[model samples]
Every structure is written in structure tokens, then in C-alpha cells.
Target: MSRISHLFSGTALAICLPATAALADLTAEEVWADWQSYMSSAGYAVTASEVVGSGSVAVSDMTLTMEMDDASGGGAFEVVLETINFVEQGDGTVAIELPASTTMNMSFQPETGENVTVAVDFDQTAPNMVAAGDPGDLTYTYAAEAARMALQGVTIDGITVGPQIAKLDVTMTDLAQVVKTTVGTLRSVSQDMTIASVDYDLAFNDPESDDSFQMKGAMQGLKLDGTGKLPIASDVQNLNAMLNDGFQAAVTFTTTGGNYDLSFSSETDGSGTANATSTGAAFDVSIGPDGLLYDVSQTGVDMNMLLTELPLPLSFSAAEIGTRFLMPLQKSTEEQDFGIAVTLNEFSMSDVIWSLFDPTSQLPRDPATLVVDLSGKAKVLFDFLDPAQAAVLDQADTVPGELNAVTINKIELDAVGARLTGSGDFVFDNTDLATFDGVPRPEGAVDLTMVGANGLIDKLVGMSLLPEDQAMGARMMMGLFAVPGEGEDTLNSKIEVNDQGHVLANGQRIR
Candidate 1:
């Protein structure tokens, strides 16, 4: 049996020291050899001074540098972290501290972007680095006035917001296994002549699996605030390259407990030929144990874009987007389960008619009040080798191919204040969609009912999706022939799709 003990001083961080005389059974050279062996096996290239300090163990400072290799290939690039003058506390922790007259240098390269180099110096005694206990305490500090960014041609809002210089002051405190960890703060100072005001702060903590994440700060207040119109050729080139030589907007979202909040905004103007601007937007939602609850609100968004020679000038403006919604997530292990809910909201859009239409009062004559309710669920996978989740494999990422056999239990959507509802359910065999090139395509049945036929038809006609004459004629036909199992005013329809992609309405295939 063996024992290891680490020292914890009250009001101070715990430090690693040589094991008590009980382990005195080993000599200094023997201990150093063991240390080197341990670090190498754990994937670190370790080096240290040979001179052993007084007493039995070889007590001396050491340096360690580690870098990842791409052989394991999960991501595109590898990670590299470097630390100089890392003193091994002999117990288990390591330290990198500097006296008043020390210099530091480090470089960082992202997955696919410009390289940033940072150099730091200290005019005072920096913080100490302690060992890693169940939770450990480690601190370091550096005076900035030496950081630089070399972004060849990056600009924002018509301003060349690159070729930057700045200084950073940082302090870090990490406590392992303990109840809490505190990372003090970071402060950055930039050159006085700098035109843009860009500020950023970020912090996070994940104590254990059972506990939730704690966020202390964020990456915010990064602004390119300048009133003068500036040359933005460099900015345009960089943006075009990043967007595959054009303009695009892509966003991803993740939610837990179906609750979230997000906000964004931007604006720009420059050169007589091109101009762009943006406004505030936000999304907020919460799903309580009671049921699903959500709220979304946004405002002031417009993109008046022009690419010469294009027939349709791209223009848009949004006054607001707001919604209140509720729904429940239900499930059962044995029986199939499903849930339903709806959202009540208003969304306003304005089409900019720069040439032929009035720019003022750009809002259309009719504002939209959108009401949508939806319900859906899936069946449990019964097969072990070929699961049901595989059936809809194309719809998701990280889905096991064996789970494709699972079938949809049911799905339904209600739109326009419940005036319309469409629903269907289906089962699928072990077949891949791509391979369906030869086999008969899967088949499914659908039922749709449109109530308030006359009013709905009028709304459709107003939107120009349906001509007034056609809408009136459809409503008149519904009046002449009553819907099966329903009244004359409602339009009831049945749809059947076969393996050959042929569709049928009311038992007649319309291929």
C-alpha cells in the first residue's frame, strides 16, 4: 500500500511538497526518474534541471510543452499550448511566475484565419502557480502594452478596423474539485489613435456533471463606431471570401428546457456606390414545467443591398416580430405519445421600392397576424440491429443508422387561427432514401380540412396567391357539395401518395 499527501494552507492556495519520510525509502535520483516517466506517459514533453535540492528528493524547477497531433482526426486542426519556466512543485502542481524584470511571448492561430501574436512583460512579482488538488488554485499576471494583431485587410462599417495594437492585464485563479472556482478578471488597453472601440470578456465554469454551467461574462461591446465614410475595399474582399465570394446569413440555435434569449444589431454606410445598415433584433422563450411558454420580440431591421446589373434590387425592412406561445413535451415508455401547442404573434415587413414605388409608407396595406399550432411524435424503435431512427436519418446529424426503422406516430399542423389542420402518420421498412432509386418510394396518407372557406379564400386572394375569381369559384363548389362527415362551408380533402410518386385526391390519383 502507498499514500500521497498534499499541503493546504488556510487563507492560501494548497501547495505540493515532497512526501513525508515514510516515502524516504526512495532517493532523489530515483524520484526524478519516476517523475520523468510519469509525464512522458501522460503526453507531455518534460525537461528539468539535473541538480537535486537538499534532502532526499530531487527538488528543482522544470519546463513542459505540449501539442496535439492530427492523427486522431476528429477536427480539422490540432491544438498547441506552451508554458515557459514551469516549476514542478514536486508534489503534483506546477508554477510559472515572473519577477519584476521578465518578458513573455505567445502566439495563437485559429482553425482558418489570420495569426495573432502576443508578448507581455511584468514590472512586479507575478502570481504563483500551485499544484492541482481535487480542485487546485493557480494564478498568473502579465502587463500588456505589447499585444498586436495583424489582420491584413479586415474592416467593419466601412472602417479598416485592423492593424491593431493593444495591451492586456490578466489574472486567473483555478480551484479544482472544490465547490467553486473564481477567475478574477481581464482588462485590455488599446492605443489612443485607434478608431474603433472593441471590448470583449468571457468566462465559464462546469463544476461537475450533476451541476449546471455558470456564466460570469461574455464576448460583447465590440464596436466599429465611426461616422466618417471610409474606403472598405479590403473589408469587402475579406467578407466575400469568407462567404464563398458572396453574401449569406447563417445561424445555429440550441435550447434546453426550450428556453433561450438572443439579440444582435449592426449598421454601416460608405462610398457612393454601396451602403448597408441593420437594427436591433431579439428572441426570448421559456418552457416551464407547467407547459411550453415562449415570447419573441424584435425591431428595426433593414438590408438595402444593390449589386449592379441585377434585375430585382434587394431591399427589406422589419418593424417587429413578436409572439407568445405554449406547448407541452410528453412521452411514455410503453405507449406512443404526442403533444400540441400554438403561437400567437404579429410580424411586420416593408418592401423598399427605391425606384418605381414610394419609399415612404413602404409597409404594405395588410399586416399579418400569424397563428400556428403543431403536434407531432415518433414511435419507439423495436428492432435492435436496425432501429427506427434510421428512417429519417437524412433529417438529423449524429443519428445512428440502425435507428432508421423507427416510424412517425403522427404529425399535425393548424394554421390561420385553426382554420386549417393537416395531419398524417406512417411506417417505414429498412430502406435508405438514396437507395429508393430502384425500389418503390414509401407511401403515406394525409387528411386536410379548411374551415371558414369563404373567409380563408378571401385572405388567399388578397395575398395574390389565389385569384379572386378562382377563390370564389372554389368556395361556391364547397357550397354545392358538402364535405364528407362535415358541413357544406368546410373543405375536407383526402390525399394518398403511392410508391411511384403518384398522388391521389378523394380516391383519384392525379399523376
Candidate 2:
């Protein structure tokens, strides 16, 4: 192939090659060597398995392996190893035709008794990278297992059991600087369990601590298929709990200049006879450069089955469920900065109700579907990093710098056939949220609005949960908050909820 100079211009940029008139006779090996050297010198720690055969102009086959150590200071405990299988073509650039595969195994021990080891296997492929001068297709299959989960001095697992596991496969087109790093299709198989020691508390005819009791299930056929250009600075971390101390992070993500759509689905099954499943559901996720511009519309699902006839003494049927969120997080730029808008199309809840009386889906109630349409936005205070930066946040509260200001843009909620709106600014004081010094406290206020105070008052009255006099008082209060007679409905009430979860609406404390 002729050595045509490549120029990368837009989001999916390519490696630009300088145009030259003098055509030197550079072989495939020479080109590969130059590319390898350039990457290695740029801190890639490049290494390849021994090339099996030798050729200059057109080497047909070879394998290249490389490991990228985590420069994030977490130690060799964090590293990415990749091996690619390629073939040299008639062109000067080699064809990275197959995905580069990698496997990772690491162990970590915190001051707490949590011990974790992760085993990961995945392959990434990009065809005609150097030759086509464009990022090629990439696909990966990966699996992970994590054990021994603990939180706040409470051990959630018995006998150091495994509680987190997953198997995943994904495919993307023009992945590497080619088609804007947006994901195409991703499918995953997962199993997770959480068995609390409380189940063994002697108060319930429980077995000894040494006796083994477990709960485990598998989520199969989980898939997410989507397309859009990946933003240059987007959070694309392939999230793995075992590998990163249970901290939340995205494993792989990209920014798409244009809008894109995606969907997800899965089912759950288990070790025992529950035989429960949640299925036949889907989602539409839209992506844009600004943020997640999504219109979420999905059904919440639940299925259950009884397992009492077996060896154990539990008679309640199992519970299976699913839920989805379709919302748009507006861009922070001035053009769209007022309030974040969101909508939840349909939310359904269904479960088998066990009756010492009966045991059949017929006896169980019909599946319930809840249609919710909500839109709202709240101002963000500061970055919410898990466990990290906890101390700094605590200090900010004590001194009252940025912590003292109310942070919000706007918020709207349309759920369960009801609509409500709220906007408020709150300070991170000693008890509202975590303080800058690591102290935990709860303090915040939310100003809310709702349509038809009189209609709302009547509903509350019919519910009979509140006294008639109180309901009347509430009606009067609603009148005070009522918006002008015509335009849009409104309610001007400040809901002050304190550290102990005590709620006070318009000075009347209600916990």
C-alpha cells in the first residue's frame, strides 16, 4: 500500500503523519519498530512476546504483549497487561487485527480485616490501526470475583465468603481514536450475595456461628448495547469493586460528539430453589457531549417463588425486581444551566405475597405498574468522592466557607401519578452531611412546590393518617403557598430536615 500521510481532525482523531515526497523503502518491520519505540519512549512500558518468525517487507504473523502499570500510585497491585495478535500486510503499517488480551491478579489487605484478590481476563482488538490510520474495532470479555465484604465494623459475610462476581463481554467500533470511543454493545453475567451475621443471632433458633448459611445468585444474559461519540474528558473507568477497594468508578466510557442510544437487560437465578427471575425489560440511554442526555422509559419488575418444601425452614416465596432511570443531566455551560430536566416513563413493582393461607400466583395480587414522570435539578455543592476527601469536607463545615452556601439549580418530580417541585440551597454543617473534618452530621433544606393545595389537602384528609384539624391547618398552609390564580401551579414551603431525620415544614416540626 502507498504511504499516504494521515491527518486526524475531529473527535475521533488519528495519528497524523507528515507528508513527504521522497519515498524511502521502509519495510513493515521498520515501521513497527519505529511505532514501538515511540510508544515506549512515551512512558508506555512497552514489551512484546518474542516474534516467532522474521521478515522485513511483509511479515505475515506475530504476537505483541504489553503491560501498563497503574501510575496512580496504588502499586503493582494495579496494572493492565495486554497481548495483541497481529499480521503484517502489503502496506507499511501492521494490522492489529485481533483484540489485545490481558489477565490481572492482585491481593490487598486494609487495616480492617477485609482481604481481597481479583482475577480478570479481557481482550481488546483494533484492526488496521497504523495502516488505516484510524482506530479499529475493539472487543473484550472479562470476569472477576471478590470476597470478604465488611462495612463500619460490621462483617456482612460469614466464613469469609465470596459476595461479588461477574462475567462481561463488550464490542465497540473504531474504539481507539477512531469513532469517538462510544460503546457499541456490552453484555455481562453476574452473581452477588450479602448474608448478614444477624441471621445467626441466637434469638431466632439460629445455628452456631461456625455453622455455614449462605445466599448466592447469578444474573445472567445481562447486556447493554449503545452508540455515541465519547467525550475527550469523560469518566470511563471499567468499574471493579475488588480491584479498587469497593470504590465506585466506571471501567470504560467515552465522549460522543453526536447523540447516541443504548439499552440493557438481564435475569437472576440462584443456588437454592427460589427459581425467581426478572426479565423482558429494556432501556433507551441517549448520550451527548454535554452529559447524559437520556429519556429513560422502562418497567420495574419482580418475580417470586417459594422454596419451603426443601431442607430449610423458610416458607416465604423469593423476590425478584428491576428498575430504570431515564434522565438528562444538563450541561454546566451557560446555554443550558438553569435546571436539570428528567423523566421516568414507567415504574412497576410486583412480588409474590406468601399467605400461610395459600401458595399460587392466582392467590398473589396482579403485577402493579406505577407510571412516574419527574423533572428536577439541585445545585451541586462540591465533588462527592467516596471515603476520600471525607476529612476535608468535615473541615469546610466547621469554617463555613463554600459549605455555608445553598447549592441548587432546580428539581422536579413526577412519580406514582403525583407531581412535586423543589429548589433549595444547603450548607454542609456538622450534622447535615459529612463535615470538612470527617465528622458526620445531617443538615439541609428543600423548598418545594405542588399543584392544587386544596386538592392535596383533601387527599391527605381522606387518607386519615393525619387528624382532621391538622389536615385543615395544612389546607390553610397550602393556601398561603398557592401560586397566582392562573399560570403555573406552585407551593412556597421550605422543608427543613435535620441531622436526626426530623422534618419541619414551614416551622411545624414533623419527624
Clashes of each: 19, 46
Estimate the TM-score of every prediction.
0.35, 0.40
Residues 178-274 of candidate 2 have per-residue lDDT tens digits of 2212112221111111111111111111123222223333332233343433222222221111112221112121121111111112222222333
Give the TM-score (vs. native) of candidate 1.
0.35
lDDT by residue (tens digit), candidate 1, 236-321: 21222222222222111211111112222222221112222323333334322223345454444344544434455565544543
Name the weakest run of 10 consecutive residues (lDDT summed) in model 1.
Answer: 1-10
RMSD in order of candidates: 17.4, 14.6
Off by over 4 Å in 2: 1-44, 52-74, 78-83, 97-118, 121-131, 134-343, 348-453, 483-511
State how far residue 136 of model 1 sits from its true place (Å).
14
Q: Which candidate is the best by TM-score?
A: 2
